[model samples]
Target: MRSKEIVIRDVEKTFQTRGGAVQALSKVNLNIEPLSFVSVVGPSGCGKSTLMNLLAGLDTPTGGVIEIGGERVSGAQEGNAVVFQRDLLLEWRTVIANILLPFELHGVTWLDRKDRTTNRQLAEDLLRMVGLEGFGDKYPFELSGGMRQRVSICRALIQRPTLLMMDEPFGALDALTREQMMYDLLRLYDQYKCTVVFITHSIEEAVFLSDRVLVMSERPGSVVRDIKIQLERPRNLSTRMDARFLDCVKEIRGVFQSQGVLAEV
Candidate 1:
C-alpha cells in the first residue's frame, strides 16, 4: 500500500466569539492515502468547513497539527487545490481565461507572455475534458450553474495539484445537476488520480462518492466513525441500488441518528 499523503494528528480548532470560546474541532485524526476519495459528513456547525480551512492553511489550529505529504501545514501548499461551493470565477474573464487564472496569478510569466500557446492549448483541452470546449469563449453569466461549476473544476485542476479539497462544491445545484456533477467528478478523479477530501452533509452523496466516509459529531466536532466503502468503481446510479450501498447509507445514517443530527427524511 502507498504511504499516507495527508495526516491530521489529534487536531483541534477553537474560535473566540463574542459569546465565548467556540470549540470547532476536537481530537480529529485522519489519514488520507494518495489517489483516494474521502468524504466528510457532519451536522451544520460541526466544523466541516473549519477542518477544510485548517488543511488549506486559511486558518491555524488552536492545538495539534496537520501535515501534507509529511510537511507541517503552515500555509496553503502548492500541491493542494480547493473548490468551494460558489464558482468564484472572474465575471469579466472568459471561461478559458478564468481556467488560466492560477498560472497567471502565480507569475509564470513565460507561460503568460512569449509562450502562452501551450497554456492556451492546455486550457482548451481542460475545457473540452469538462464538456465546455466550444463554450470557452463564453462569460460566466452565459453558463448554467452546472456548466459554471464545471469550469470551476477545470480551474482547480489546471494546476494539477496532488491533493484536492472540495467544500460542498455541489451543494448549490439542484438534485439532478448535483448527481451529474458527482459522476463528472468521479470521472475526473479517475483521470487525475489525485487525493480528494470532500465535505458535505448529504449521507447519500457521501456514500456514493467516497472510498471512505468520516462521520463527524456535532459542535466541538469529532470523528465518530470512519467507514471504508467497498463499492465497485466506475459507479453510476445503478450502484446506489446495490445492497452494499444501501447498507453503507443505513450505517452512516445510524451514526448521525445516534448523534441526533440525521436530517429529517
Candidate 2:
C-alpha cells in the first residue's frame, strides 16, 4: 500500500467550442503531499473536475505540467484510478466480478496465476474493509445507492492505485446515505495508503475528510485558498461537532462568503 504525491505547476486549460477559447483554469499550482487526503471545493463550472481529469491523466493540460510520483502524466496511467459521482457499475456483473473487472481488463491475471490469486483475495479483503462482507455475490441492481457506492470504492481499490482521484463521488445519494458514505470513505482511506484528491461542494464534507482543502474561485478557476485541516483523524459523525471542525468548515465557507457566492458561513 504505497502512496504517491502529485505536483501541478502553472496548470492551465482551455476549450475550443462554438463559443471559442473558453479558459477553465488559470495558473493553477498545487502539491498534494504523499498519502494525504485533499479535497477541492468550488462553485459550478469552476474547473475542479478539469483539474482532476488532468491529474488522472484523462485529459491533457494546455499549459504547464502535472506530475504523479515525479513522473509526468501523458495519458491514463496504470497506477491511478478515478471514481466519478455516478457509480457506473455494470448492472450485468456481480459485485465481486465487477471489483475484479479491472484486473481482467488490464490482463493483470494473465501475467501469472499468482497475480490472479492475490487480487481475488485482495478484492474480498477490501469488500469486508468497507463493511460489504457477504454482498459480493449480489448484482449491482440488488444494492442500494450507498451499497453500490461501497462496491465502487472497492473496485477502485482493487486496482491498488497509488493515486485515487474522485470527482464528487458521493454527491448523488440522499443526505443520510451521503453521511454514511463519508464514514465508509474515511475508513477506506485509512486502510489504503493512497493519495486521494476529492472534489466536493460541501464545506463540511471537505473539512471532515481532507487533510487540506483547496478552494477555487468562480470561473477561470484557480486555487484561491489552500486551508490546512488541523483536526484529528479517525473522525466519526461526532467530529462534526468539534469546534475546530466547525471552524474549518466556516473558514472554507468564509472564502466563498468573501467571493459573494455565499451569504453566510
Candidate 3:
C-alpha cells in the first residue's frame, strides 16, 4: 500500500501547569502530502514534539482534528509508527531481536531467531538496508550510538508503516556521526517511500532532508513559513553546501530571528 496523506486542522494543545494553562500550539493547520519528506524546525520550546505526539495518537489534541488516510487519529494505528530521540532498544535482546520486537507485540506465531519466518526476514532485510547486515547478533550494548539508532530505525520500519513520525531521532549523535546518520536516514526514506514528518531544531538538517520545510513560531507554535526545498534530491552531505540549501537554512533562521527566538551571532 502507498503512504497515507495527513490532514491536521486548527490543532491546539494546552497544558495545565501550576501557574496556569500554558498553551503550546494554537490554530495550527497542516496538510502533509503522501510519500513526501517533510521536516518541522523551530525553537526549543515550540511544541514540535507535542504536535508529533498528537499526530502519533499518543496524546489527544485539546481542539481540532488529525486525520491519516481519512481516519481520525484517536489512538495508535497499525499503519503508523514513531521513532523518538532515544533508541529505546532492549538491552537484553540482540540487534535482530530488537527489530522483531514490534512483530512480537502483534503476536505473530513465529518470532524466534531460529525460526525462518517472513517477519524475521523482513527484520534482517531492514538491518541490511541500513548497512548493519552482520550486526544482527551483536547486542545494543556492543554498538555505538549511531549503530544503535540504525537498529531502532530498522525496528520502526520492520512492519512497513505508511506514516513514520520521527522526533529528533539523531539529536544525541556527534557531529560526524549525526551527518552520516542523516545520509543513512535519507537513503532508507527513499527506499521505503513512507510519509515522514521529522521534528528537529537544526535548520540545515531540516533543509537537507526535507522536500518541504515548516518553520514554527515560539511558544504558541504554528507553522509561520512553509518553505519548499528546491535542491535536487538523492542528497548527500555535500548538498549542505549548495547555494539553494544555504538559502533555505538562512530563511528559516531568519524567521526565528524575527520572532526573537534567535539572535545575531
Model 2: runs farther than 4 Å from truth?
109-117
Q: Select the stronger candidate by TM-score from 2 and 3.
A: 3
Off by over 4 Å in 1: 1-4, 110-114, 263-265
Residues 1-265 of candidate 3: C-alpha lDDT, one tens digit per residue: 6888899999999999999999999989999999999999988989999999999999999999999989899988887889999999999999988998887788665645455467777888888888888898999999999999999989888878898999999999898888888899999998888999999999988999999999999888898999999988799867978889888888888898899888778
Model 2 steric clash pairs: none
lDDT of each: 0.90, 0.90, 0.90
Q: After superposition, how far is residue 5 of candidate 3 from its true place, in Å?
A: 1.4
Which ranges of candidate 3 are over 4 A from the true structure? 111-116
Candidate 1 lDDT over residue span 36-73, tens digit each = 89999999899999999999898999999899878899
- TM-score of every prediction relative to native: 0.95, 0.95, 0.96
Name the 10 consecutive residues with the lowest summed lDDT in model 2.
106-115
Task: List model 2 lDDT by residue over 104-216, tens digit each.
Answer: 89767576989878887888898888888888789999999888888888889888888899999999999998998898889888877888999999888999999999999
List per-candidate RMSD values in Å. 2.1, 1.8, 1.7
Residue 96's C-alpha lDDT in candidate 2? 89
The TM-score between candidate 1 and the true structure equals 0.95
> What order do you get sorting by TM-score, best first?
3, 1, 2
Q: What TM-score would candidate 2 get against the native?
A: 0.95
